[model samples]
Target: MLYAVVDIETTGGHASANGITEVAINIHNENQVVESYTTLINPRQFIPAYITALTGIDNDMVAEAPYFEDVALQIYQLLNEKVFVAHNVNFDYSFLKHHLAAAGYDLNCRKLCTVRLSRKLIPGKASYSLGKLCSALNISIQNRHRAGGDADATSILFNMLLETDHEGVIAEMLKKSSKEQVLPPHLDRASILRLPNQPGVYYFKDNKGKIVYVGKAKNLKKRVISHFTGNKPNKQRQDFLRTIYNVDYVVCGTELMALILEANEIKRLWPENNRAMKRYEHKYDLYVFEDQNGYLRLAIDKHKTNNKSLQSFNSLLEGYNFLNQLIEKYQLCAKLCYLQKTATKCTAHDNGQCFGVCSGIETVAVYNKRLNNALAELQRLQPSFALVDDGREAEELSCLVVENGTFYGMGYFKDKTYLADGLAPIKNDLSIYQSNSYILNLILNHAAEFPQKLYKL
Candidate 1:
């Protein structure tokens, strides 16, 4: 089989918004390069200073050269029916595919990343970057960042890989069922292969072992694989994929558990790629405090991390509605609760349920007594329960405990008799996690859908 060992110098990292400045292809027959092609193209855009600095191919160098459209057919003819090979194969393949299609040519072929091949065949290299790997292997790259130099260097590395691949690693990777081409070049296949086919939270880590992204999945293996399936060609997606060198995961007992854990992990780790969850915060909250007059006043206000809240709500309207219900049920004064702003008596006082607290007719002691009773009732109303569900292993059970309207934590337990002992014993065995309104809602919704799993404490 023949391979088109390819490389390109681009105006930027991603394809959709960037332009290819130069390209080189060396046709290889497994043993050696039989043919070679290289060209500088006018990309119709200003090349950035950094790109010029790295490649030494400035705008002036390509001003009189042909545009990609003028040479698209020639490039296509050279690549068609040949295995496309490159240092980081997806980067080159995606750029060429996007440009070729825009030029009215459909370029499609099997892809092989020399980075992946080197990791498999060569092994134990400190770095897989073309310059670094080539230098480490004592292969001299004449022009460094130039397309011809990189492509020729890559072709030589490919030949070395072919020679060393006595175990047929290349053949196995080239199979239709292999995930080799779909994965990021920096990541090992074994990292993906070891992922469990269970509900979990997965983390994407960079080469330096820093977590860049965190995601939740009902099936860890399936969802992790899905990220590498498509060639998105966007800057964020391309950068995200390229940085991933490792994956870590935590197995959960249920999808709801996975969702909760994902939110908590995203908040804790604050991964750069986790945009949506990082911005999530409970908007409003129900609060109670004592005024100078010794009246225990209740109000719904914006959430504050420093102050303790009676209950959290996603919106002001939700908090107001909940407060209104508490006022009616507990006969609390609307004026004292911040629902009535007028100098006159509150609506609840007009209805004779507020006990004239707004007008000083009710004594502070009497009002405070009733307010204390209302607070006690609120505490009584807060649901304390445990969700007992399937565990990671068959012989165990997963338990999530909610104590007085707050999520306590979750864990797997082997003892079935823990249910008979109640939430205390179960909480002892479970691992603690931070709770938020989003997580509580998930658990509440799941409990509503599957009441059989709900164990009220």
Candidate 2:
């Protein structure tokens, strides 16, 4: 089989925004390199100082060199119908594919990553970077960071992998079903293979085993594999893929439980790649306190971690709207609830809805009693129920419990009789998780759609 072991030095890390400064290709016919090609191309852009420092390729050096378009046809011809090999195959493949397409050439070929091969064949190497791996293998590199030098080094490494692969590991990886071509270079096929096709929260960990991203999926294997399916030549996507070394997951009974677990894990881990959930915060909260006059007062204020809120809202308007409903329903004094700023009696009192508490005609005890009733009603309205759903196993049952307006937690139980007993036994068995507005919304939406699954406590 013919293999085009290729390498390129670029202006930056990503392909879309970056320009290729140089490229090198070595054609190998299984046993040895048959032909070689290398060139410096005018990237048509300014190479960053750090790039120039690393690669020794600057604007002045490539001033009169041919642009990528001038050599696109030659590169395409050399790579066509060959197994495209590279240290990290996708990086070089993406760059060439993008530039070639722009140059009006369609370059399509199978891919082989020497890094993945080394991880399998060489095994137990501390590092697999081009320079380090070459050094460890005693393969000499000429130009170091330059495209031609790295390509030559990679060619020699590929030859060694082919020679050492007695078990036909390379052939196995070349198969369409292997998924080695699309997977992150640092991540192994086994990690993905071991993932259950169940609903769950998956964690993507880096080389040091630090959690970098958290995600929920109804089909864990399908969702996790989807991340590596596309060749998105963006900095964020490329960087995210490069860091993933392992995938770990927790199987849940239902998608709703998976969603809840995902949010909680993201908040707890504070993963670097988790953007939206990390920034999520309940903007407003309903709070109740006693004034010096022994009157109970309610207020909607910005959420504070130190204070416990009766209810949380995503916006101030939502908080006010809910408070308004409580005012109309419980005959609460709008002024006492901080819905009005006027020094005179509140509009509710003028309309005969408020019981003259603002004007001091109503006794504090009576007004306080009414406010307490409203608070009790609000707690009652907060649904305390258990969502019973299909478990990970047929013999087991999954239960998500919310009691007294707060999410208690979730767990799997073998006994179906937990449904008949009170929430106390279920709570004792379940694992407790922090509740957020996002999780509550998901649960409420699920309940609305499938009310039969909901068992009120």
Candidate 3:
């Protein structure tokens, strides 16, 4: 395969924001350079003084030069279907892809990094900078920071790597390029391509068909592609990719539905990568219980599944802190709520914050009435409502159902009759998910952020 050794000077570090000022590409056949192209293009934006000082290519110099738009098509044609070779390949490749995308050319090419190759083939180098590496190898560079000089030096270094490569590392790297799907050995590209470009949840299955990971995305195809193409320098990611042998997905009509499905699936499947959810240990809970006199009392107790807590907290401190605020705001007896222990009237009653229910000075009927109101307010934390938002299409809307302060499910409804008449069809199409602390937090935050979209049904 032919290699296009490339180097480009940019206005800034970010590919999406920066403009290309100069570029050089040297075509090689794993032996010697056959053809070379270098040009200074007008970026059409003011170049920073530091960049000008570094590259020696000021705006005045490029004023008469051709703009990137003039040469974009030609450069794209040259690099098409060729292996992209560069020192830090991502920088050059990303810049080209961004600029070419703006120019309406979808440029996709396999990449070969000289720096990664050097690390494997020529290890133990003190510094891997292009200038330092070239200097150590006695390769002469005419212009230190110019695109042409850097590209030529890189091409020579690449040829040396090709000649010394005995273990087929270079071949393996080219095969793992991001231009195409980087799937596991047992998985096929056709499976990934079949994923829809819509809001959905996707599953990564191992070789034995056991789900290893579950994730949600605004676009299933893009998110799945990002997982395989990411340059994660960790063993966990490598292990995950290696074990993924099959792909599965469920399409959601909206982003909100995707999130709910993701949380539910992670909790249900208990996927290997989703251990964080499994490790969630509920330590404390805000509980409501009845005393011997039929008086309703609230306490922050140690959480238990059988207790069926009204609200759960990850820590005792959090539960107590929240209880303290409720005692102060609702003028409730701290002794009754377990915030203060007392034989007679509580300290809140002496402070005129409580109605003296602990000492029977106030009738249970009057005191219980206020306590029930406070409990009802706290119960409203998770509202019983249906949030209707924009769906994947103009004719539909996504409905998120929370029945009696519990997450029922989510679904898409196309007929307007559901909003005006009945919800039988919408209820039948709902995708149910487990109601846990994580899911509760998500629903609460979204409802608060977009209250106008919520319909309290």
For all candidates, the clash counts are 0, 0, 0
Q: In angstroms, what RMSD does candidate 1 have relative to the true structure?
A: 1.8
The candidates, ranked best first by lDDT, are 1, 2, 3
**Could you tell me which 10 consecutive residues in candidate 3 have the lowest summed lDDT?**
177-186
Superposed Cα deviation of residue 48, candidate 1 (Å): 0.9
Ranking by TM-score: 2, 1, 3
Name the runs in model 3 displaced over 4 angstroms. Answer: 2-178, 280-283, 292-294, 313-318, 328-330, 342-344, 360-370, 377-382, 392-394, 421-429
Models 1 onward score TM values of: 0.95, 0.96, 0.57
CA lDDT for candidate 1: 0.92
Tens digits of lDDT, candidate 2, 1-457:
9999999999998999999999999999999999999999999999999999999999999999999999999999999999999999989998999999999988778889999999999999989998889999999999999999999999999989999999999999989898888888999999999999999999999989999999999999999999998677888988899999999999998888899999999988999999988898888999999999999999999999899899999999999999999999989888889989999999878778988999999998898888888788778887899989899988988899888777889999887677788788788889999986778888888888999989998
Residue 90 error for model 3, in Å? 16
- Which pairs in model 3 have colliding backbones? none
lDDT for each of the candidates?
0.92, 0.91, 0.81
The window of 10 residues in a row where model 2 has the poorest summed lDDT is 415-424
Question: Comparing candidate 2 with candidate 3, which one achieves the higher lDDT?
Answer: 2
193-310: candidate 1 lDDT, tens digit per residue: 8999999999999988999999999999999999998777789989998889999999998888899889988888899999999989999998989999989999999999899988
- Predicted candidate 3 versus true structure: per-residue lDDT over 72-149, tens digit per residue: 998998899999888867667777887887899988888777876786688887767799988888888889799999
TM-score of 1: 0.95
